[model samples]
Target: MAPSKTFFSNFRLSNIVNLLLRSLQLVDGLVVIGLYGIDLNRARKEDKYSDGKWVYAVTVGSIAAATAVVYAFVSVFMHYRSLTFLFAWDWVLMVLWAALSGIFGTMYLNEKVEMEAGIHRMKVAVGFDLAGLVLWFVTAVMGSLWFFRERWGGRISRPGKA
Candidate 1:
């Protein structure tokens, strides 16, 4: 159904969970950006220098935040659900988060960190990225169910739901 149709219809438990998860995704992304961004800004102040690692992390965090906002808005205002699109994006996010986690983890283990606070921030960043990975995985599974719903005698796709 179109988002407009769902808006006035019953508000199900799934809707609440959807909103909660999306909100968490958005916040988690912002937190990672903020954590890495502090170091990035400090580096700029010290000598107009920024580490590539922090830059890459911040970029990924920005992408995560933007996806959460855009997808949530579109799902609410345009379609009640876009299963295929959501599924694709969830997987994309999952990979990005995994990469972020792996990169930060490697960097930390390599003993290249310079400051205690920086170490703390990196650990937190990895935590958030892993959380994002799990969240995306969960959403991807939910999206998969939508595809199966059509095949298993659940609600078949309407004309434009594809």
Candidate 2:
């Protein structure tokens, strides 16, 4: 009998982290959208900076989420040993995005607080933002370690081998 093909066959811890990252990014996007809607409904006048901040958050979250999902699928489903460069690039980009997301989330929360937005909605948004940031940070660290291992850590020569 032939062994069945399954996702677990090619799965790695990094893949799991990628999936988690994407899921958290998707949730973050949704939460940002919800916050934007609240701001729109409650605003007495247009505030470009406020609206722009939410829009930026939504855009970054969405793009990062989509990229992560696609990368996860490709990394797991495809045999791309010859594409190590691409894989490394993906990890680099994800780490950069995670850092940016964390900074943006913190700034958004601080701005919202200073604006004295509604306590209930602000609190909810803050909670979601923090959760997403934490997830992103974890994914970034995991991805970095995986990339480094692939590139450098695993290169130690065997005891007597050339």
Candidate 3:
């Protein structure tokens, strides 16, 4: 959906991070489809994917939607606020985490697709999964904390006193 004017007003650094996370998921989903060899003929004829492909599509699609929402929120936020130190840090971290996840996840998917290639041993695939999981977890936790802080945390000061 196109962003609304109010979206600009509610921008937050955390929103941008969420945006990156979602985008990565979208790309990952596409990679999964390609790597797993999507049955385009079946999809077109049957109007649905094969067993596993459907799951990947739904999960990745959800992420893409969520990312779009974050994009809207961040665009709105940026409208009201300058790109200050906090904003820059948030963007940098978000991009870094997303890129890391993409790299490892792509490797994992590619290896899974071409098991006969033998370039990535079983042990190596396990390592890639572990690394991807770590990055995903860390990014999720940080994004959630930022969301909570922006949505709920605020100074509760005594009235007219410090």
Candidate 4:
């Protein structure tokens, strides 16, 4: 495709996708943090915050949001392609979100367990946590696409080639 000479046209399609996904990441992180932060505060008041699941959820959510902000600055706002290293970090973030979602999911899905009264909130958190995982996974896939397109250069050699 020929490059267009317009303000919005200057940006690549993938970059636009990254921007939208990063926006979703920011929102998912904030929602997860808000969902758990209130409980975290209450737990702290009750002296259980240090060992509470809410603490972990809030911390991971905060990190996800912070990372999304920086990534958006470098990748979208600066009009830079996906940094190769971000692929690894994206996987790491995906795993963290997966863990968060899995833990909450089990709590929310299991009907036989009567563990905590707070498990009721896990239903909402599971959705946002899973959303975080999906967002990071999509970012990682995009980064991989960039890497393969730029670095792989899949040139096949035939046996008859001299």
Each prediction's whole-model lDDT (CA)? 0.77, 0.57, 0.46, 0.79
Best by lDDT: 4
Every model's Cα RMSD, please?
Answer: 6.2, 5.3, 10.1, 4.6
Q: Give the range of the ten consecutive residues with the poorest summed lDDT in model 2.
A: 79-88
lDDT of 2 by residue, 25-120 (tens): 666756655665566545536544456655555565566556656655665675333234444544444555555456555655555355554755
lDDT of 1 by residue, 67-118 (tens): 8887676555444354444677788888988888898877675555466777
Report backbone clashes per prediction.
0, 0, 3, 0
Candidate 2 accuracy as lDDT:
0.57
- Kindly list the per-residue Cα lDDT of model 4 for residues 1-47, writing each as its tens digit: 54344545647777777778888999999999998887777777998
> Model 3 off-target regions past 4 Å?
1-4, 38-135, 147-162
TM-score of 2: 0.59
Which residue runs does candidate 2 get wrong by more than 4 Å?
A: 1-8, 40-50, 79-117, 155-162
Q: After best superposition, candidate 4 residue 94: deviation in angstroms? A: 0.3
Ranking by lDDT: 4, 1, 2, 3
Error of 3 at 72 (Å): 8.9
